[model samples]
Target chain A: MQKVGILGGGQLGRMLIQAGIDFDLDISVLDPDPNAPCKLFANRFEVGKLTDFDTVYQFGQTVDVLTIEIESVNVDALEKLHQEGKKVFPQPQVIRTIQDKRLQKQFYQTHQIPSPEFVLIDNKGQLADHADFLPAFQKLGKDGYDGRGVQKLTSPNDFEHGFDKPSLLEKLVDIDKEISVIVARNESGGMRTFPVVELVFHPAHNLVDYLLAPAQITPEQAAQAEALAQEVMLKLDMVGLLAIELFLTKEGKILVNEVAPRPHNSGHHTIKANGTSQYEQLWRAILNLPLGDTSAQSLAAMVNVLGASGHTGNAHYEGVNDTLGVKGAYLHLYGKKLTKPSRKMGHVTILDQTLQGLEEKIDLIKRSIKVVSK
Target chain B: MQKVGILGGGQLGRMLIQAGIDFDLDISVLDPDPNAPCKLFANRFEVGKLTDFDTVYQFGQTVDVLTIEIESVNVDALEKLHQEGKKVFPQPQVIRTIQDKRLQKQFYQTHQIPSPEFVLIDNKGQLADHADFLPAFQKLGKDGYDGRGVQKLTSPNDFEHGFDKPSLLEKLVDIDKEISVIVARNESGGMRTFPVVELVFHPAHNLVDYLLAPAQITPEQAAQAEALAQEVMLKLDMVGLLAIELFLTKEGKILVNEVAPRPHNSGHHTIKANGTSQYEQLWRAILNLPLGDTSAQSLAAMVNVLGASGHTGNAHYEGVNDTLGVKGAYLHLYGKKLTKPSRKMGHVTILDQTLQGLEEKIDLIKRSIKVVSK
Candidate 1:
């Protein structure tokens, strides 16, 4: 058995280490937060900043392979490690591109990948020149996650109040529906994809609320989405899991919305529904082992359980027994201590054969459980 | 969330902690082995002998509830804790009775539970006096597992070399098939039982090699097995998981073979084939939560992969890729280092909707994977 180290140790890393238990491999994790969920599972927990060059370099030196759960880690150290003949999945180049919104959009455009039109603003001074694109989105180029770095613009006044950091603005694609595809590629270039998933947003919080695997799209549309995802992963040429978020335009055109190079929120349902979960695929992708089956054995629906409004202490879930009483509901808690409004606390996955029945169960779960302070 | 402490840390404890990840609870383990498989995932790991009174009592005091993964733990410490108003699942008396074969068999007899006729022997010197019990089995009363402390007697010569210790001799039942049913009883006595499973043993190793869930039996026979298991659990009067091993004779008779007060090998298939796994059911039982569904969604087959003959040091599996190539096979590797002949290392689970397909897949897996040293 060999040792592997992950860069950021949050819930994604937590689940990844859980998957690693079935494989006879030694795993370690490094995170700045001593209470990070991965600390409880990984063979070793080194509490240090992920972006510090010395810390990452030292951690990378001790493992046979290195990977990341979050993309905000130090890429320069990763490049140095790769130069010294150490294995790094999704190589440094992939991380560099994904960390910057400007570079990600540019890569898609240069590779003839379909995406919405966008322009980069190096600083707030450059925001005024992009006033022509009034009704667009301003996204920070780096170090942003969840729903944090995105702002909708309607006039020049909104642009004046935008972040001074490097950013990109793009016209919102006229999407009829949002969908995602998770693809796994091994070091040998063996690639497999999960069934496409449909994402429905919560209007009040603007976060993804409902997701359906084996998205209810026509066969032709499913084929088109899978093909686009394949092209994107092949172009990236990274050895790991990639989640491609895409938009189906009202005119029936598919456009790449954004790209993530590690385990993403949309793929969590795979742990319960697919033959090989996205986390396990990432393991195979790194070990260069045979990728297990990526097919979904059943239809699944997912709902994100966020921290309820006006709660800010130790986290406690209410009505868990009631929500669990609903048939076909399974939950995964992150084991985080503090809960703030709209913070990602945990998620519930619902597996059912009928979409209508799954929807009804999802409704029952949403109304029953609430994450709040005791 | 409250913390629960497990007394032993082997593969059973490893699987229990894996199941705990989904629930919002803190878990710890106390095992003497520094390299116990549970050293990583548990919230706390105390490296102390399970039989040492002070060590067990100290560990028990830190958690709200105490349970056991193996029966050899210190029961006196559990009794002391129970007197101190702490919760110990299965209670102290259950472990004490189940630890000794004589007491366990007597418990069954007093409760009118159907079992093979047996007589207790104070020592090996008294073996010959029971000539009427010729052609029977001599089993040591305590501290025996996996084919150890058990002997078959067919003549006077066999009894002459029996163990010189407290033991019991029983009439060997002619078994048509061996089956096991797992029953869970909560604090309020709410109970549930999983479908019966048939176990097949390997001739050369004398160990269970293959298992099939939803055992192929007449509906009437299945009902009888379930009723027997329910009676055994209710008599034990414990709040935890109980696995009852039973034998169906050639004359259509059911006899209780033995009982395990924690998670058992025959229930492992629940991880893949049932709506709720035995590990999860154990948590629900101890926590006094409403029990989850136990219906088998699909027929499942399992094959044990033991260490090959004449192999030791550093475990490495051969042909895992090929075994996993089977359409529905799932592999679970116990992170054990040493490999000895016939030592249980891991298992492969195959799930299918049809019995014919499941049998074929089980055969493919059995011939494909071999556990050995690198």
Candidate 2:
């Protein structure tokens, strides 16, 4: 019966609301967009800047527990609310540490977590001093999201692509595959991890293009990935879902790439493919309830439905009927009204008993669906 | 996208909204209760009487298609809407027949569908003329719902229990097991049926208590049950979800007991246990989209969380946390505010790869959870 509030009512908040409805949870959402996806669905919705101290603090006062779908929220307000006896999941300090790439790297280094080596830089001018760290990626210390604020710097000639403010130069790893492990921790310190998922990124968009659950890896590798994810979550001392992206180096090392403090794209297939979905897990963690089983029900694949190129107007899904025709394909449209090239329109989760079946259907799904504008 | 309007906004409508949200379908609902379950979540909600001619007629004009979660709506309005080109699924005529017990029985007999033998009666005085049909059930011609408006007659002394209006005296079958098969048909004639589910009724309340999917029946029996359900839907010319409740007589004959023209409690487990949920199938059928695969993802059972016998006030769920601790247990609260004795508060679905695991968990769930007034 707890009144829960969420910051940022985009697709993640929308999906969380879908899961929360099952438990009849009283959920409210605050998003700056009056036309947010959760605008029409949330029990109560208030349009306000998530980073405005007064806006967030006032919103926090109306709910028993507060959480976020995005990480760029006003942490100071959350800290004040936490001190005021309201439950703020993922913890204010955890959010603050993750809000900055430099702090996140430092936390990993301080904990001896096997993440990629990194050096903090104050501005683009400092890139020259880190020439020895060439071939690294420069990521903005804050305000970056969904692959937007990181640029590859192979040499001094690429320095112009580096962030001009507080940032970090992260040494690129020789990755064989990119995988993610989603872990959940409750207030009681109960932790659980979903099956490791293999991610395939869009070449140009730097976003997850498609992913396979129970990533093709030896049990030892999976256990190691799960263990590393758990170590990072425990070290952060966070309560809620955490998505840890990792690099499976050619040398067979499981090195941490980055971590998201909430449900991540890697786990979206869980709604249909796992024993419990990440969205449901978030609710359990924030509500201080028992965590759910994270076992995969079957081999599954998720393909993001990005907006079709050259389309930008009222959204009209092409081939949705055909996609629905494919057996085991579950379409989840975010209810967004417009379409712009590469925008996250929705996703489809395909389930099958065999890896071969999954591979074939995923190919068909990728070729058949497009989000265009009318 | 086509707009959809629902006649009622109770649990069934709430669930349909959940499924519809996945497809980003535009949905609206009209229920007399301002606090209807779908009020907070539906794309649009209007507080209007579903049985009011003006309310139902005017409401139907605002959507591309109209449907119902309950059958006691203004069918005359729907009939007019259907004639005027708006899609009224289950068809107004189907609702008309199914709404009256006498008409439903006659339709079955006329279609050569195997069902309980029955004789139409004009009043309670006519019951004495059918002494040979003693121990039969006298169902009122209209307005009978759940277990109400129906009474058992075993002798002349029980004639007082019969309705004074038009009714039917149906010979009760030598019952063994009660089962349901949900069938879906679309505008283009595409049809699909979910696995047969065995139902256990509450002895005191004529409602389904719990059910097991792929009901513990022989393959031949299962097929026969499914075929009978299909026959009923085909005869009714229904386009949408139809829940066919059948009586598996002691002789192993499958006889039609009754039918509901929308999602039923027997198919609730499909939400998590099947490849496609009944709620989703309803949307597919109504939208003229391809029917989804109805294969069971795993062996599953659902137990309704009814309000405790002595409770009647604002509702509070007890032991939800404990019930949640059981692996594979999925809780779905209906969000109803009151706790009346025998009222359906919610349901918990238990899934497992083994039947024994489901049976054991069902017992535990039945014991641990209680919906009470607080």
Candidate 3:
């Protein structure tokens, strides 16, 4: 087995390594935090900044292939490594484009991919010129992640919320629902896709609250979503997993919301719902192996387990026993020591033959379990 | 979460740790082999003799609860730990009884479990005294594993093949299919049985060649098997996973063949086929959490990947890429550094909605993969 190294050893890396173990692949991980989730199981763990070029270069040198769990990793070193013949999946160029919101939106537009209308702004003052683009969102072009560096500007009065740095202001879509399609492309140009899933986000948190697999969409809509995801992946000319978040407008139009170049939160339910998890598909893609079946075996719903409000310090789980008592509920806790408010702690996957049963369990899980500090 | 310790660090321990990662449990393993499979993923790995009293006792002191992956571990140390209020399950007494063939057989008879008739004997000389039981099997009372320490005696002329040490002569039932029902009992006395599975053994090797979930038997027979397994587990008062291997005689009678006090080979397909894997079920049992659902999500067949007959030394997999291309095929490779003929290197699980499709994939997997030397 070839040695595989991952940058940013958080829960995604932890899960990818877990899936890799089945193949007996030798895996190493580099993360700035010594307590990163992958530290315990990775074959080798290097504590270094993922964004530091020298740190990434040294780590990438030790492996035959390199991939990332998060897109914030230093891509220049990755490009150099790829130029020198080391395999880097979702190639550095793709990562570089996805890392900047401006480039990501531009890439979609340039490829004729349907997305929301947007205008580039250099500073908060520039927002004054785009008042007609009101009822929009001002998103920083760089370093914005997981609801951060993003603000809704519904009117001229919201101009103060805009970033002073370069940003993109986009008109908001009246979303009927949000959906994600995970697609895997191998080096041989073989591609496979998991069933499209609906993502219902927390109204306040902006994080996925729960998701249903085999999203309740018409066959034509499902086909449209899959085709759009494939198109995005093909345009990037990428080899790896791509998570395409899309919004179905109330007017019956599908628009690309944003794109994640690596394993995204939307695909986590595949660990138990699909024949092959997104993590495993990433491995197959990066290794140039055949992509696995992406069909869902049963209806599944996943609820993210975030740290409870006003909780900090060593993490403790409450009602785990009771929650597990629910039939078909599978709990996964990322082995993190702390539990700060709203931090991604873990998730629970609920599998049921019927969507109603799945929804019932999801509600039960949400009400039963809490990640708190002891 | 309490710290857990496992006595053996083979593939079973490796798998247990893999499942435990989901719960973020702190797990440690004690095994004599420095390169034990669990060494890579266990939170702590101690290279020490599992059968040594001191080593077992010292290892038990480091964890809140202890369990075993192999039956050969030092039971006296486990008994001592249990006496000292440390949790050891299936409980040391259950392990002790299951460890010796003589006691295990006697236990079944005393409890009126539907097992084959057997007679305890002191030596080969005693076997000749019972000519009526000539076609029985002579099984060593202790330290017998896999297919070792057992010989088939068809007539008085075969008495010379019997063991000289204390052993048992068990009457062989008329030929029929073999099946396994895995029952789990938690500390709270909650019990659950995985759907009965049929095991087909290799005629030459006497080990499970492949197995199918939801064994092709009448519902009445399946119920009987589940009832029988539950009866055995309740009688033993064991707290953990118990794999009950039984023979469905030609007369339509189910007879107990043997039992293992930990996760058994018959349940490996559950990792992807069942609602909850046996590994996770075992964790729930020992941890006193509620037993999980054991229903099959999809029909599944598992084929063992043994080391090729003429290959040895540094292990390598042949045709992994091609085999992975098979739809619904899931490969699990134990991280063994070396391979020799007939060594259990890994397994491939083929799942499908129909039994015919599953069997076809199983055959394809068997022909496509081989464990050989580099």
Candidate 4:
């Protein structure tokens, strides 16, 4: 059996450990919190700071292969581990490129991948020269996480209110929808891609509500999205799974939004909808095993359980009885005890054979599900 | 969070720990082996003898709810814990009734649950008095684990090699096929049953090979099997999952064979084929949550990966690459390093909408998979 260690022990690492149990591999995880979700599941859970180079390098030395859930880990240590023949996935160079928006866009430009045009500003003073990108989004070139670092600018007024630093001003394109494609690559160079999925955003919150697998799009558009996602993986030449978020322009062109080189949110429905889940695929790829089937088992949708506003105590679910009764719905609570406003507590994957049935399931979820604290 | 303590930590306990991770429950397990399958996953893995009254009773004091993966545990301890207000599922009385074959058979006869007629023999000398059942199966009424306590007394010669003690000689029925139904019951008296599954045995090994869910039986037969299984749960008056193995006689009658009060091998397909798996249902019943749907997502079959004969050092599969290429196949390997002839190493589940497609998948598995050791 091979030993596989993970960089972070959050929900992604936790899910991977759950999936990895089926294989004849030893799984370990490193997280700062002893109470992390992956603490119990991983064969070994080491408490350490992910950002500390020594902590990550020391952990990497004990495993045959190393991969990550979060991208904010120490890349320098990963590069050193790779040099020591530890089989670091996504390659340290890949993370180094993605950690900064400026270099990520440069990599996209160099590879000629279809993406929205972006120009870099060294400081807020340089914002005037890049005024043509009004209605653009200014994302801090480094250290951005979740949805925090990016600020939408409908006008120059937005710039003064956002982070004043070296940033990439991405020209916002008129898009019909956002979609994602997850591609898996193994050490043997075997690769496969899941069908494109349409990311549906909540109307008021503007965060993703659920995703429809094999996005309801023209056959040509679906092909375009999948091909573009594959191109990104091939260009980056990274092992393990990569989730490419794309914007389907009103004109029907596919433009890359960003890429995550790990098991991702867009593929959460895979656990119920696909024969091979994204988490399992990560293990297969990094372990040099065959990539699993990425085909959808049915028309699938994923609904996230966000922490309820005005809740700030140990988490308690409201209306789970009514919600699960909807049929074909799988509630995956992330085992986090606390609840704060808008936190990603968990998600539900509802699968059906038809789009209408999927929506009915989704509606049932929205009406009956609430994540609160008591 | 609610604390759930399991009595054993074998495969069933390991799977429940895996399934329970999706729900926010603080899980713990008591197993003597430090390397128990559930050790890595349980929130607290306590090393203790499951059959020791003091150990079980003390462990039960720590958790709000108690359950078991194996039945040969200290029921007296569980009874005491129940008396003290700790929730013990499949309650001690139910276990007491099912643990003894004679008592179990009597319960069926009293409840009018169709079963093969049986006559109890107090000793080997009494076997001659019960000579009318010459072709009966002489099963020891106590301490039976696996296939050790039962034997087919086809002739007087066969009796020389069977368990010579107080036992029940059950009249053998002309069986068409063997099937199983999994019934789930909760504390609120709410109940549900999975689709009837056809259990297939390997002729050479005399052990189950795979089982097909929604067994290929007339709709009436399917309904009859499910009703009988539900009746068993109702008669036992237990709260937990019960796997009732039944014989479908040539005359089309559904006769009860035996029952297990926890998750069984027959329901393994539910992990990938049903809306909710049997493991998840156990937690839901024990935790007093709403029972999940038992509806099948597709036609399904599961193939057991028995350890190969000849070499045995550390377990390794010979041909996973070609087997998984069959697609729609989910391989779940128990984390056992040593493999010997006929030992269960793991199982592979193949699911499809059509039985024809399923057979093709099963054939692919049969030809390409071999559980071996390096």
Best by DockQ: 2
Per-prediction DockQ comes to 0.58, 0.77, 0.74, 0.65
Interface RMSD of each: 1.7, 1.2, 1.2, 1.7
Clashing pairs in 4: none
For each candidate, give its TM-score against the true structure: 0.96, 0.98, 0.97, 0.96
C-alpha RMSD for every candidate: 2.0, 1.7, 1.7, 1.9
Tens-digit lDDT track of model 1 for A1-374: 68999999998998898888878778899999998877776789999999999999999999999999999999999999999999999899999998988999999999999999999888988989988887999999987788689999889988668989988998877888899999989898888888899997878987677999988899899899999999999999888999999999999999999988999999999887887789988998888877878788788998888899999889999877777666667788888888889788889889888988998888889998899987
Cα deviation in Å at residue A361, candidate 2? Answer: 1.0
Cα lDDT tens digits, model 3, B194-240, are 99999877789986678988899999999999999999999999999
- The parts of candidate 4 lying over 4 Å away from their true place are A203-207, B160-162, B202-207
Q: What is the TM-score of chain A in candidate 2?
A: 0.97
Minimal lDDT window, size 10, model 2 chain A: A200-209
Q: Residue B25 CA error for candidate 4 (Å)?
A: 1.6
Pairing residues by index, what is the TM-score of model 2? 0.98
lDDT of 3 by residue, A108-151 (tens): 88999999999998877888999998799999999999899899
**Stretches > 4 Å off in candidate 1:** A202-207, B202-207
In model 1, residue pairs whose N, Cα or C atoms come closer than 3 Å (at least 3 residues apart or on different chains), thus clashing, are none
Question: Taking the tens digit of each residue's C-alpha lDDT, what string does model 1 give over B59-99?
Answer: 99999988999998889999999999899998999999999
Docking class of predicted structure 3: medium
Model 1 docking category: medium
Model 4, B242-285: lDDT tens digits are 99999999988889999999999999999988878999999888
Model 2 per-residue lDDT tens digits across residues A113-203: 9988899999889999999987898999999887788889997998876789999999988888899999999999999999999987777
lDDT tens readout by residue for model 4, A162-191: 567888899989988999999999988999
